[model samples]
Target: MATELTAPPGVRVDAPAIQRRTVRLLFVTQIISGIGVTIGISVGALLARSIAGTAVSGLTQAASVVGGALLAVPVTRVMTAYGRRPGLVLGYLAGAVGGLFVVLAAVRGWVPLLFAGMLLFGGSTTANLQARYTAVDLADPARRARQLGLIVWATTVGSVAAPNFAAAADATTRRAGLPEYAGPFGFSAAAFVLAAVLLFVLLRPDPLLTARRFAAPTGAPDAAVARTPQAGAPVGADAQLPVGADAELPVGADAELPVGADAEAGGPGPARRAGLLDGLRAVRSRPDARLGVTAVAIGHVAMVAVMTMTPVRIGESHAEADVLRLVGLVLSLHIAGMYALSPVIGWLTDRTGRRPVILGAVMVLLAACAVAGTAGHHTPRLAVGLALLGLGWSGTMVAGSTLLSESVPVDLRPAAQGLSDLIMGLAGASAGAASGFVVQFAGYPVLTALAAVAVVPLLALALRPVPAGAAGAR
Candidate 1:
């Protein structure tokens, strides 16, 4: 039987058990929180259109993306200082508050209030995104992608189901003496609260803190150090941390791990404040990591640019009275595509390699754009195209995220991850904000084509040769 790994200083722990417990808790959290976020997404734009105008409809999603990106700074710092549990709990509660604000905004027909609420609502997404990172805190290197994918896959149940409930949520709120559009946000607020309480009560010992303890030498001083590279130490290729895996990280992450070498050799050293710039530098210093960020950012931007404008396209093209219901159904199908096959995407990342999968994802994205661009009022083709778009996003997100996590040394992982997410959020925000204007002028087909263009750079980067000693680069 394989020996169970334990932390040092006479404090023993079954790493596998902790990991399992962590995954389960996070999975449940994802489901509950997923419903909260997706419910808002299904109707946020339409709600904005009711109060504001078509040009500003996309601002709701943009605000959420911006909120998530900006929030990542403090959340990452909290996780760095305290641990995952506190940070995650904080994020969820903030999202719940945001949901309340959104409900109030709808009641008052206030666009500014709606945007503010949407920003706060973004906190739920931040927590959900960060949870994936938490899952890998103590994961076996060999199965890291699969474990990460599982948490993402768990989101399918809630995300796919939430959109279908749009009409029900609307009716429920109408009966409650509230605006129909306000129901989803109100229900979402309750969901976020539930998720926060669950983490606060059950997420014991903290995955990140435990992982740090396990990574430390058996009797070495507390490894709760900040993840800054040592002064005068090399932060280049020679400092690469190895990860055992089959495929390289999507675009920039290395798939190759030189086992048996000290992971800390020339890597991040003694504790220091790992500021955002430091995190950015860490990713920049590593070729594979840099590429991973590129993949994540571009893929996110492309997905957001297309998805945010889709409802408007459908509503404009179809004059049906049940347009809202149609929007809800279509979004449900799109979300299903995004999350339903995550495990398979994760497994493929492990089996086929990150680069191949990412490249394939790029192709899939391009195809989605092409199909949707020409689909116009053709509901079936649009649905198929949106589904493909979701599938492509899943591939990039899983593979790119896994690569980002494994590329850096454990100590530096949080900082690097924070930087990556921040960039990704910003990229998505830009796309969301611009999508409105683009579609307003150039049309939806033009927007899809532009989104497709944005990902070409990532594809080119993924095809480039890996640098020597890059982690997860096979």
Candidate 2:
């Protein structure tokens, strides 16, 4: 039997080749998964409204968001133990089951079942969110955002198109005895299944595992120091791990450095496994990493708050005959805004720096709120505002994600990354749940105003001066 090739000391491996292959596989899988997720999200609120009424309609989406956050723990654990391929496959498969449950719930008008299904359906989002991180597991630091952005961009096709197919999917499923709003979810379930199968079959060499294999120590004397854990910077109360893969410690600072694959794997003397609190501590130890998590969380909150209520707003003022078409078009545009320009955003993040792009995102989000808030029933204005909302979301997500990934050492990256997503997802879930009440009581405009206010902290954080050591890592 043939063995896999390995890179020896002083010989750089074909990491670029592996990275390219990984990106291609991730891109295709992202498209498939994006379609599944967007189809379900597009009508999740509407379905909830039909069964549970507007008062609690937001709960379904909130459940999904929370599900995505909660699921990240296990999914990332899988990634940490096994590899990216299995982790992603696990998430997608779970999502497929959730989608089916949602369809069944919709048909039976079972509110509890619907929420449960949506929560499980959140697995797809978990997989989709993590896929971006997978793209950069072996990427060059300089082009990290660009590569991550490409995977994000791939979602544009499926996400944008899926909303437009809402009416068609609804009609098709209705004929098959499914409820009006349940057809999209039926399609969503099948899409998730296909996505899982595709990844299981073609995501070869498992990018995270491959990167771990290549990053193992080569027994050089200096490499020993890199692996040694020093007792400073407070990564955790009981643990003192590395500051980051590329972080330069200050004078007398005892932060540890990157670990080789041996430490990551459960070798004879394996390193301690990082927990969620450790990941939070890791973020706390670095200014840039804290800012990264903040940016992603705040951006997600603002986007979800306003978006969760838009369909409801349109339904209120628009003619019934036009509601479906307008909702689909607006959501399609919003989804496009979120994903269509990600590549450019990624390139810009790499060029101008993550902080600048994050600041820009805050500005765009505020602009989105301003435009959307005042639009009233004007369809064109609302569409444009939603587009800006998505654009801002893309900018923050790409830059923040890149900064977080690079700001932590490889050993702690998965945990930190998962924690960041958890925070972001929780923020979004809060916003999503509150949006319905805000819109119901104060109107859609008020919801947008609150969403705008949420970005203030992110703006302040982005404007803070970067320390010399942290700046070097970016």
Candidate 3:
């Protein structure tokens, strides 16, 4: 119930506190949505393989990847216009529709229809990705990292359960005399519906709006505005203003302004423009951003390369269908590693800083690539490599996100995040398509080796000393 305080035009002051209920609701909604998205991804690939034959599965996946890349800009614009809630709700609805189409395609064995369904379903996954940004909207500056981390961690529940859901779908569909492939899509649809309902009902008052309302006052003298409730009250309640509510006092009347005040004190115009320009400029001028982007982009390329090629490679080696099952298992393990330690990564970033984590993650990624490139033909070794790859991905992703957050002001955060995700989507899409070609020609080992080499410049950049003023630039 703290009084709403406006900072300088573009600078946003951290809110007094985030409500526990709000956080819990957002977390739960994201978890449910994540499960739906994962189910779609896990099953969609298999369905594509089934309908179009293994030879064309890569093409189908590439279509979905390209679809995701195409969707990013429009999705971000929608979120900007309507706020994340409506965008998310609409995204879920789109996914549900897509799921139904998948089920229909499976019933009819329509390859083109199945591919179209997958492209539509990809929206769900994109929406879930945007959920992390929403989680940070209401968080205090001091707690933003942890808040983002928590949302990322929440995805673990869904990711870990997704494969089981796929298995359940397989069983249930067969029992019901329906096409086996339809079951996962059905389950995905239900989960999306549930998530949509939860979001519609629970995300009250809008976290972003609440944060804006509760922020510390800016520019005006303390005496001009009334003090609101205690620091710990629920965000939107009205509190009593202090005695001199209308009286203007000296500029420095109160000591110990809230956190993020310095940035807030500057008038909004310059800061807003700077925040926008800073993110773009960082990509161009700062080695850290550039290197981080390169590492992530290459890691994604390597991941898609090995992952898309694995089942084919195993089949060529005269492996059983169970080896395909092993791919699913490995993927599940990989996802677990990617999301399970997010909170820990967030805490570490907050405590130790982002550069060290980035460097460490790069090292792990390098090692993982080496393992996959050399020893991964063996089952056990492959499993280990995939797990390490997942862990490395998690570290780099969390660290990179934290770094981006630190580099940009809150107002421009959404745009910056959107841009980053767009880049990632493009990179992942290109990699997914190219990996198949690379494996078709160059072999998996060479592809992984190239991925390993991609990280070297990033590592070198991480090793460089920060200039004196760079610390404050963020």
- The lDDT-based order of candidates, best leading, equals 2, 1, 3
Q: Could you estimate the TM-score for every candidate? A: 0.81, 0.81, 0.78
Q: Residue by residue across 215-294, what tens digits does model 2's lDDT show?
A: 42331111101123432221211122343343433211121122234533323222345667777887898888898899
lDDT of 1 by residue, 198-239 (tens): 888777756665455334433111122223333211111112
What is the Cα root-mean-square deviation between model 1 and the actual structure? 9.1
Cα miss at 157, model 2 (Å)?
0.8
User: Candidate 3: RMSD over Cα atoms?
Assistant: 7.8
The runs of at least 3 residues in candidate 2 whose Cα sits more than 4 Å from the true structure, single-residue gaps closed, are 1-12, 43-58, 104-110, 163-186, 216-272, 471-474
Predicted candidate 3 versus true structure: per-residue lDDT over 1-474, tens digit per residue: 113344323222223323344567768877787787777777666777777777876566566566565565566655543455666677777778778888999889988788777777767766676677676665544455576778888888887777778888878887998686678888898888888777766665454434433333431111111234443222222222222224321111121122222334532211122222344554555554555455556556556656666666556554585766777776767776677888887787667767777788888888878877787468667667777777777777777765664443333444556666667777887766677677778888887777777667778877777776552122
Highest lDDT model number: 2
- Please list all clashing residue pairs in model 3, or write none if there are none: 5-216, 5-217, 6-217, 6-218, 9-268, 10-268, 227-242
Q: CA lDDT of each candidate?
A: 0.76, 0.77, 0.62
Weakest 10 consecutive residues of candidate 1 by summed lDDT: 251-260
TM-score of 1: 0.81
